[model samples]
Structure formats: structure tokens, C-alpha cells
Target: MVEIVPYENCYLSGIVDMILSIQRDEFQIDITLDDQPDLLDIPAFYQKGSGNFWMALKGSEVIGTVSLLDIGGGKAALRKMFVKQSFRGAQRGVAGCLLKTLLTWSASIGISDVYLGTTTAFLAAHRFYEKNGFLEILETELPPSFPKMSVDTKFYRQMIKPSYVLPKRADLEGKK
Candidate 1:
């Protein structure tokens, strides 16, 4: 792994290509970049307030992504979390690295609740989120500002306490 870092314009093309590949090719999810406008302008959509976007890179080739969108009132929506098929697993730890990075940033920014929505097709993802303390919840429980996608059928929320101590990004940032 090269490193996990904050999103930069230099990574824009790689990010979109990798995510769309995973969604459409690997997972067979019919989503388009037009349907996801955030990918086109990540800084404007995700890099404001307490929100931010990140990419896991392999020598500048984007292999994974995760974003935190600050909805409001100490709440944020976890979005655009996708990992390439070849780079996923407990051993590879690409997904873990991305989630850890996002959580650490969310806690630092005083985000108390992080919500996310996904389809039932991602069974592994459900287990991963549950393993990381994200409890399953109904869509009605989500806050008004969460950017709910049309394909998202299942929802979850992870609560972060102000004084919570999550491992620092360095734990996985540059490690190989």
C-alpha cells in the first residue's frame, strides 16, 4: 500500500474510475457518475464543515475510497465507500484502513453520529460495518440531511462520543 490520504484533484480521475468499476462491474450495481454528482466535485460536496473525502492509493492509483459528509448538528453521512475487488479482505485491509481513517477524522471533528445506506447485495459490507460497531437502523431513523440514494435499501448508524479515542491514522496510513 502506498498510503491513505485526503482527496486531491490529482486523484479525481482514478477515484471515479475505481468506484464506478466496483459498483457496475464487480458488484453489478447500476449506478452512474451522473447519478453521483459528488464524485465530479469532491471538494465542494464533501470537503466542507466537518466533512472530507479520502482515497487509499497504490502509488497514486486509487484503490479505495470513503467520505464523510457533515449533514449538520454533529451528524454526518458516510458515503462513497468502495474498495477494489483485488484489494479487499482482512489481510489486505484496504477497507479497514479507509474506515479507520474516516472514523478518526469524524471523531476529531466532533461528529457524534455517522449514518450510511447500502443495498442488500453487499453482504460482506454489512458484516464489516457491524464488526466496526455500526448498528443497523431503519431509514426513518436517519436525519433529514443525509444524502439518501435511490438504491440504498439498508441503513446503519455509528455513534461517536466526543471523548472517544480511535486509533490515529498513522496506524494504517503508510504501512505496508
Candidate 2:
């Protein structure tokens, strides 16, 4: 079973490994963690105001990640959305679960908009965002605070409203 939960200090290494594996080995993106400071200090970068990071864990393995960065003015930026190729697709639903986790958190925290930037090479990513109600937008449309990566050429946004947060299995079972 896969569980979606918030980022914890102990899970940092797992999160970093998951992202780097996907970006380097799967996507062949020539980027290093050094160039992306946020991944190094997730709490300082993402755990403020309406921001948060989430991971999809199966057993003790981190298989997916998603982040919502509070950018002020009722807006947030989506970042670090990656799922291990083996756990992707409808059967596993790791990506969907991670996205739903972030969107649910965004709604709870009054985030009105969520934006994301991806590389043109991420064709599946573009489709995933679009399927999840994110509209494709020009680079010029992104907010000034949106962190644009060097390889990012495609951008997307999703307007959000407060909605129901599905209860977790623990919640249903009356576990803390």
C-alpha cells in the first residue's frame, strides 16, 4: 500500500534520491541538486505559510513527491512532482495521489492558484497537468515569484477553491 504524507526530516534522503533518480536516469535531465537549493532545505523553502511538501511511500520506500510553494497574493507554485516510473499509471496511482495531496493542502490553506513549470521534454508531465485541470499558459503569464528552472519551457496553472479533504485510512480507522 502507498501512503501519502507530509515531508519529515528523516525522509529527506529518500525524497532527494527519488527525484534525482527520475530526473537523471529516467528523464535524462542534466541538472544537479547543487543547482536546486530548495531540494537541500525543503523545510526552509517549502514549509512556510501555505507551502508544504508531500511524499508517496510504499513500505519504507519513497516513490513520489510533490510540493506547493506559497508565493503570496493567494498564489502558490507547484514543484518537484515526480513518481518512480515503476509506480506510475492508473494501476499504481502514485502521481495522482501525490497531486491530490498537494491540491487538498492548497485548498485548506486558502491558496487560490497553483502554478508549475516543466521542461518541454516532459511530455507526459504536460499531459498529466492538463488532465488534472491545469491549463497550459505562456511563460510570460507566470508570476514574478514563480521559480523558473533553466530547462523549464512549459508552464501550467490551476485555479483552486476550497474543497473536501478525503479522509485517510487512519482517519477512517480512528487512528491518530
Best-fitting candidate, scored by lDDT: 1
Give lDDT per model, in order: 0.92, 0.90
- Supply every candidate's count of residue pairs whose N, Cα or C atoms clash at under 3 angstroms: 0, 0
Q: For candidate 2, lDDT tens digit of each residue in 1-176?
A: 99998888898899888888888888899999998899989999999988998989999899899999999999999999998888988788899999998988888878899999999888888888999999999999999989899989999999999777799988889964
Off by over 4 Å in 1: 164-176
Worst 10 residues of 1 by lDDT: 163-172
After TM-score superposition, what is the CA distance of residue 19 in candidate 1 from its true location, in Å?
A: 0.7
lDDT of 1 by residue, 1-176 (tens): 44899999988999989989888888899999999998999999999999999999999789999999989999999999999888889999999999999998888879999999999999999999999999999999999988899999999999997765666788768674
What local lDDT does model 1 show for residue 175? 72
| Model 2 quality (TM-score) | 0.90
Worst lDDT run of 10 residues, candidate 2, spans 162-171
